[model samples]
Target: MDNQLLLSLTEKYGSPLYVYNADKIISQYNRITEAFSSVKNLKLNYAVKANSNISVLKLFNKLSSGIDTVSIQEVQLGLEAGFYPENIIYTPNGVSLQEIEQVANLGVQINIDNISILEQFGHHYPNIPVCVRINPHIMAGGNHKISVGHIDSKFGISIHQVPHIKRVVENTKMHINGIHMHTGSDILDIDVFLAATEILFNTAKEFPQIDFIDFGSGFKVPYKEGDISTNIEELGEKLSKRFNTFCKEFGKDLTLMFEPGKFLVSEAGYFLTHVNVVKQTTSTVFASVDSGFNHLIRPMLYDSYHHIHNISNPNGRERYYSVVGYICETDTFGSNRRISEIREGDVLCFNNAGAYCYTMASNYNSRYRPAEVLLYNGNDYLIRKQETFNDLIKNQVIIDLD
Candidate 1:
């Protein structure tokens, strides 16, 4: 989105707002599809944990994209957005068997990650088809805190435990329909990702009835100018050929699947916050915005970098300023960043705010969550309203303390 559009959006909807560009999301979806166009059967399951707005879900649905949900609520959201159950894959972690059963009853594809859950589900519902998520023990992602494929992560079942998985399948006579693995997010090395896929392919050989192999997506997106991100085209060209060969060796064509969250929507989002004050401290200049970690926590949580620019004065002389939030914590977005001169009331645009920003927001410090807008078809629509005091205390109970 342009500066004027963003400024206008903040003026219309208010600051500390989220605006998503539909065209950008669509183009990202098409980019991946075209990258792997050679595959006979391909599926892109948008990870719902990234951005679970019903409108965003509906946009993905309009694109004919499947959903990879991690919770019962997300699965329900997918259904509410008009997605077919079969097109929605529920891959929850550390949840109860009852929740899995609940999701399964909805006819959604169940992907079990741990051996205990796998055994429990298989024993109870042997006839149901399931997918196994294997931990290939591959390390990838921008931060160690965010990486899950390592041996220490509690995410997927260890690859060494494949024999145990087989035992569970055999004892229960359960059907394994798919094999899945996710190395992590912001994967920059195609070789590392391909190595992880080799492990998934090797594990897939154990399940003859599998119809799909999901190489869980962690394709990185550029976070800053000239930032090095995953080379989707090159990875696709090499992996597509390898996948086709693997299908031949398996003696059957299997559907290739990717569950991308950030890669598809990160660049499409913009977080516009109004500069509340310009504080000149002893040795640093702090441009504090009205919002804080309550609204965008990636910087504090994962040390994630979201490009910040002064959209209101793009051509002004540049200066070093530390962008901070009003939250009563060490909530800093950027430190010592050179941007154009920022004045009070000027709207600053945070780039790549699409994927995990809004979904991770909370009502911390009793602050209200911001509203969301969608720029679709040359029109802007407010997808979510700014939370009010009523929203904050809606579910809260106050005791009669007389």
Candidate 2:
């Protein structure tokens, strides 16, 4: 987006804002589907936990995409966004059986990843079909924090425990309709995913009534220029052939599904924040912004990299500086990064802020959450307003301190 237009947006709405380009999102969604168009039955489920914005969710629905929900509230949000209950899949981690049962009552597809929960839910609801999340014990992304399919990870039932799962299903007479596996996020190797897919294919053989296999999405997007990303085209070509063969061998056509969150919207999002102060010490120059981790915590929480540029001075001489936030504790976005000359009140735009950014925002230190905007057809529309003091205390009980 034009720097002047972004500056105008900050002036018109407020600083510390999230701006998304709907066109970018559409293009990304089309790209993924086109890549996998060869598949007979392909299902793309937008991971609602990524951005959960009703507008974003509605946009996905308009794209004819299914929803991947991890909570009952997300299932409700999907329904509110105009998705049929049958089109939504619930894949929550470590939630209660009551919550699962509640969402199941709404008729959304349920995915069970734990052996104990599988037995319990199956025993209680024997007729309801469930998807099984398997842990292939494959290490992906190399980051322990993001890797979920390793042996020690708690995100899925272990492949070694397949006998246990089969025993539970047989004992409870539960119907298994789908087999699923998610290795981790920021996946760069298609071979690792294919290996995990092989595990899922093998597991699906145990459940003769299965209708689909969800290879949970972690397809990496380029965080910066020249950064290695997932090769979706090649993956589609290879996986499509394998999936078709599997379907043929299994004597039925099955749905191939993925739940992509970051891939569809990360590039579509831009986080805009105004420079509040320029602090210079003997050793460091800190470019402090009006927002903190309360607004975007990826840097502090995940050691993630978000490419920041000085939109205000695109042509200015680049200099290395430390970008920090106004939070009370240590909050550093990047250390010793070269950016264009920054000035007080200048707008710095952070790329790749679409997924897991706003949805993870908090009210720490009583800081109001930033506003959100959607840019469509070269026009800016304010989708969410900046929080006020009332929002900070809306749920608090101000008990009398006599």
Q: Of the candidates shown, which would achieve the greatest TM-score relative to the real structure?
A: 1
User: lDDT for every model?
Assistant: 0.96, 0.92
Candidate 1 local lDDT, 225-257, one digit each (tens): 899999899988999999999999999999999
Clashes per model (N, Cα, C within 3 A): 0, 0
Model 1: lDDT of residue 341: 98
Worst 10 residues of 1 by lDDT: 139-148
TM-score of 2: 0.98
Candidate 2 clash pair list: none
Give the range where candidate 2 is weakest over 10 consecutive residues by summed lDDT. 140-149
Deviation of model 2 at 368, angstroms: 0.3
Superposed on all Cα atoms, model 1 deviates from the true structure by an RMSD in Å of 0.7
